[model samples]
Target chain A: MMGLNKKDTSLFVVVIVLALLAPFFLNPFPTDSSMAQFNAGYPDLMQRFVIFGIFAVGFNILFGLTGYLSFGHAAFLGVGSYAAVWIFKLLTYNVLPAIMLSVIMAGIFALLIGYVSLRRSGIYFSILTLAFAQMSFALAYSVLSNPKFNLTNGETGLQVYANDPQWLHRDSLPDLPHLFGLSMRSTYEMTVGGWSFSFNTGYYLCAVILILTFYLSIRLFRSPFGMMLRAVKSNQQRMNYTGLNSRPYTLAAFVISGMYAGLAGGLLAAMDPLAGAERMQWTASGEVVLMTILGGAGTLIGPILGAGFIKYFENIFSKINDNILHQWFAFMPDGIEDFIVAVIHPFIGKGWHLTLGLMFMMVVIFLPGGLVEGGQRLARLLRRKKSDESPSADTKPAE
Target chain B: MGILEIKNVGKRFGGLQALSDVNLSVQENSVHAIIGPNGAGKSTLLNCLVGKLIPDTGSVTFQGQSLLGRHPHEINQMGVARVFQTPEIFGDLDVMENVMIPCFARRDGSFRMHAFETVMNEKELVEKAEQILIDVNMIDKRHMHSASLSRGDKRRLEMAMCLVQEPKLLLLDEPTAGMARADTNNTIDLLKEIKEKRDITMAIIEHDMHVVFSLAERITVLAQGTPLVEETPENIKGHPKVREAYLGEAQV
Candidate 1:
């Protein structure tokens, strides 16, 4: 849990390679093929995959390290999105200001919340944060909605229109933001052995930022600040008695993680150019907690894996209908296919969450360390079995 | 003025008087031990010294500066660090990392926001922590998790955590409260070693007479939220008031 072991480092490398190569290797069907239902190669879904990955990764920094169960984290993400949207409307449409504003705003929000909430630990802290988040949600829906509709654009949400200033629009820019005069929004394509893939410019940008954020989180996880957070989590009283103020350390972690959420929100708005109040909903906030816990709370890469797994299931399961099930079971007998469809049909629409819930339960019950510990257990079992088999083979020399 | 002075400090929780007008002081670089029975408010006094509890009455002055209203970390930054009754080292962090935290707080006064520079690469902090670890004879276990150490070793690590700050005054609450004879002897030796190597003024609260007699230069006997006697350990060992206050009731 402290640092990456050799096996984990190799696994991390393998996972990164797989994530990069997934579009070409996993999605074999044409873009418009009926089998595209299972394909997560689309820009919209891929954007979500990374955006939520950032969200859960930030969350793991707080709940995972400090064991502070914050029920109001979504408020930070929502506030971040709103701040970013306002930046887009007021200033240029470039991502730099939007992201900066989001991070700063979220940090300020966390400072206020953490100042009050950190006074009490455990259930009290959770309740305090929950109440604050609800208060924010209420304000966003009620006051921030109609009167200053120009800022947030209210229930309709803020969206970019043709009339909006296009400072970031490449065709209009006198001197565009480019690497060696090449537009940042350019993509490079590659094809091999009847398989074609396009690496998206936006996706690459998101991937790069995520990697940087991931690196920062890793550095933080290994630092003294990180140690203080764990100290706060383990025993606040002891820490207080030890002439250490646990409050400031907890507040710092809260702000840093909140900034990450803001960055993610800004990136999401950059990809799609819309900021909706619904994005900051408590359910959305809870979704990242599920991802972090299901993946592995303390492990760095676990949250990303958790985010991808949940999003993959969410997209695939929600899209499946009875007709799609029938198409898959066309090769089987009518009786077996109908039985299988009947068993799975109820969990297709709103029921996709039921599957997520079951997966979360399994991960929690059987693998409390999340996917990271599960992987370690599997590796250990394989090594043991190998050693046992080799010894047995030597003993059977006569054979 | 005494280096670390407590004047008429009293604390009340509901109707219970945890500490009532308890006044004491330790001169610089002296080993001062505060002894009391269970629930005698020894910890409550230490809490007041380190700014954990705001006293209902009286003033706490460190080197003639007011200590009230300062946060614990700020107090630590101002050269006052405490080791807990229970060893409170960061369990997940390695020993070196655990020690490095106080060094960071001492140097920066707040968590540094830079994510690029490695904390270990800070030469002064690493050298200071390494030196403290050497003093505690825990240099060999510096790479291991602080939690993985034995009880005595955890106490040593936590002591190193405070020592890294180079505090003017240090506070210890029941530092050897729960230990076997061998571990207690080991802790006594470690404290003796640290005392000789560092110029730190420590106020230790102990239930172990052996530890108090072996380490403390001066002893303060606390009974019923008040200081009964403040004297040298030699004088404190034979005092009738202390004997009647504690030893008469127990086998000590």
Candidate 2:
């Protein structure tokens, strides 16, 4: 059971099954059907789901367990992406080295940031992290992108160019990222009863890494170190008095989470072969925080669910247009349909963020534990009904 | 030599001297009680011992090592455990977890990377934690969230947390500060039982005369950041300096 308890083992198995069958399950709608646009089986989007899942899972280690809200995680992610892209430019186009280098680089960055930021706790800690991230973003955007010695390529982003020296790469090899000639973009397509499913090699690779990291995260969540982190969150004063140091534990959690973000960023570069300074923005950092909180902060599965939920809404909801809305509501009376569309228009399409904001507010107010708590509440209610009927069933048999 | 020694430890905050030339010694395996009126520097002295504050002058040492510049956890690792005035148990953790943390700290020192070791797999730690909980008479409530415990139970749990460390020196700041008579007596009895069974030194600061008289082997009365008298409980009761400093009245 990979050191997991029975319940966690089962949950792990369920996630494996879900990830394995995602292509088939996600592409449920026929190609020509009106609901085809809702299908999320595309390679690009699926890659995003697992990549961000890794990011949030790492974030949960720090914020969920240690209760240190880092407002600059995206800086590590950005650093990872830049490291990955630089690896692609100077070294071979193979993703393994790029991914490894990105993780290491991000870990180093996180260690520096965490060391300074952890000296302060509460909102002061958060502000310090934010300041560091902003400084990193500014460096990447301008200072590091000077013409004489450009590390990042300014606004155009860092990418592989034909003239760049890739020492490990042969001229005959394809320029795109690959695993021993199996191109990351390679996909296998199948059509069954007018429904098409596409399985991309890159997506599967990311999915496998995500599952491994998720398993590691689960182990960490149940470990003694995890308990120590929780104790830090609960009462740091007591932790210190109990002969436990809080700084090293918090810093370790920070570095681990930062590495996760780096892995995610490396995967992003592997998929697109570009690293942008925009990835380091505070808004990007806020998105991951929203994902962690909206799913449930402390729970193992909550962050993944939150990341997927937000990304799905971001992609699918933004695709909605007035014409599509009008077509869906055509069955209703013209006046009523127009009125409904007008009312709903602002919350969809480009305004999908408004809907996300509203949902986040609702979750914070009604379900402080996030969607996981909501699911648990539902499960409890169902269990209660089953228990209530069991006694009645026994009485009926006696009668 | 005593296990803990403080010599001429003075701390000044602006114009007011919080603690001025305060000297105290705590012997091994003895219970020393420090009693003081409000703003009498008892807390400041305790903070200095636990490395929460740096005295402006003089040295505070435990086992012949200076504790002046050490961090709180480092001070704790040197065999000093502190109990706060209000119970400082981890409210979010269970009772068992609250006790187990100190056991981990004791076994692993200040910090160890036990990130991958499942807590359930730590059989020895679990046994040790359970044994301490049993000693504290809280084994039955081990699974309960610590925050749900009554005030007295919280105090017991906090004491259990400190005791699990098996610290050589225990610093308790008013262990029964806000408790009723019954709870106070329960705490006193628990401390008495702990003292009987363990070869530990304790430094207790208290306002309650009943608790001080019942538990302390040596008593120090502090007034306006200076020790008025250091004597056995029987002698401290009739000492004129203590009576005047405490009651503002001259002995007849």
Candidate 3:
């Protein structure tokens, strides 16, 4: 099963099936029905889901396995996006080169940043990364967007323009972000009974990348290098005395994860040919942290689950307005109905952060292992119930 | 010359001199013990050998190469392995994995990506690690998490981790400190077995006289950051200086 052991192979298969069938699975409601707003089968959001899933998976390599909390991952992501867009501007609208350059550029930046930041550990390491990300953000926003030499193109963002020298661009190729003639935003709509689904070229591309990257991450987790990273988290003193340098191990992880972030960022730019300074902001860095923890930090599938969970919630929850809340609570008495809507209002729409905050806190406090732990507990409970129904449990003494 | 040599080593921390004018050498294939009471600079001397602390004066050399200014990992790569007072096994890793770490470090220098190959695929390393586990009588607990093991088991795991490296010089800092009498005896037997089977040189620092007398071929008594006497266990037994250092404890 793709060189993975039994458990990892099964998990990989599950993820692959989910990624390929996301459009159908996400659009579980009729298009004209009231639940249509909850449907997340659209191409744009689906691409985001896989892209951020890749980001969290990469971040977990450093933060989850090595216990190095980096707060500047978005800098690499932003750097990737900028590199991709520059490729579009300088070379062509084709995404292949953009994605490749993005990874390489991000790797170079990560080498520099990681070499400096990895000198410290714990909160100081986190602060060092956060400071670097903020500096990158500030530079991208103002300093690098100068009139004489514009690298980031300032607050307006860097985008492909008609006047730009896209030397490789031709009349036959699609002007939009694409692989050759295949446009990224091109979608095929199919209706089965009351349900409608969109299978997008871009989402599938992102899905393929996600699946490949996810498999690579699994290999990393099972490799000797992965074991070393875990040792870095467990006991650095033991690791050092065993003739292994913790610094190089962590730096390599940092660079590798940075490249993953770059891959994700390139995908984002490929989906939409614009790289904005906001993409490099600290909030964006923090979002991936939330995704990794909310799902499970060290587990292979946890980050993907977490990314999907946070992105899905962010989309659907933010769409809910006061009107929607009032409609849902209309069955109650007049005063109680208003109170119910008022209570729910703060958790939806513009107040989505409150909900995310609450969920993050609950995950950290009760489910320290995150959503994966919750799923494991459920599986254990179900197993217990099944065993209890059988005579073997009562007849057998507890081990 | 000895495998590891300390020439007039000195170390200071703020207002206090932790160790000063210390000179000693651990001969090849012998168990050398540095025994002293609390705050007697025994641990500081061990730290200097393992690269944890750099002496302000004099040199610490291993196999004729200076151990000074080198990182712990670099020193370890030069065939010097250390076991801590408290069993500093990788607590989060399982038993077999804990032992295999030093094996990996031994096989693959200070750093290697090894990003793709599965650990199980390295049959050679796994077999070597398992063999060491067998030698330590811990093959049955190979799959168990190191943290869940009893203190005695943890110490054994730590010992296995060091021994798998087959270092030229093995530094043990109070290897049986805080152990129950039965556990201490087991450790002594383990050390004796290890000595019988290997060509390794051991440097042990202990406060327990029973442990020192049981394993040490040579004993160095330290008092107030200076060596009082360096002698064999038979000669150190009735030495007046040893008696004074131990406050007339008949156990010496």
RMSD of each: 5.1, 2.9, 2.1
Evaluate all candidate structures by whole-model CA lDDT and list the values in order: 0.78, 0.93, 0.94
Per-residue lDDT of model 2, residues A1-399, tens digit only: 878998889879877877778898788899999999899999999999889999999999999999999999999999999999999999999999999999999999999999999999999999999999999999999999999999999899999998999999986776799977778999999888899999999999999999899899989988989999999999999998887889999999999999999999999999889999999999999999999999999999999999999999999989998999999999999999999999999999999999999999999999999999999888777766776978553322200
Best by DockQ: 3
- Give per-residue CA lDDT, model 1, range B37-144, as digits (tens): 778899888888887788999899999999999877667777887888788877877788778777776777645544445567789989988988888888998888
In model 3, the runs with Cα more than 4 Å from the true position are A391-399, B248-252
Q: In angstroms, give how far residue A262 of model 2 lies from its true place.
A: 0.5
Show model 2 residue runs off by greater than 4 Å.
A392-399, B250-252
Model 1's i-RMS, to one decimal, reads 3.4
Error of 1 at B75 (Å): 2.5
Native-referenced DockQ of model 3:
0.90
The C-alpha local distance difference test score for the whole of candidate 3 amounts to: 0.94
Q: Candidate 2's error at B161, in angstroms?
A: 1.3
**Rank list by TM-score:** 3, 2, 1
Per-model TM values vs. the true structure: 0.86, 0.97, 0.98
Proportion of native contacts kept per candidate: 0.29, 0.85, 0.91
C-alpha lDDT (0 to 100) for residue A67 of candidate 2: 98
Model 3 chain A: which ten-residue window has the lowest total lDDT? A390-399
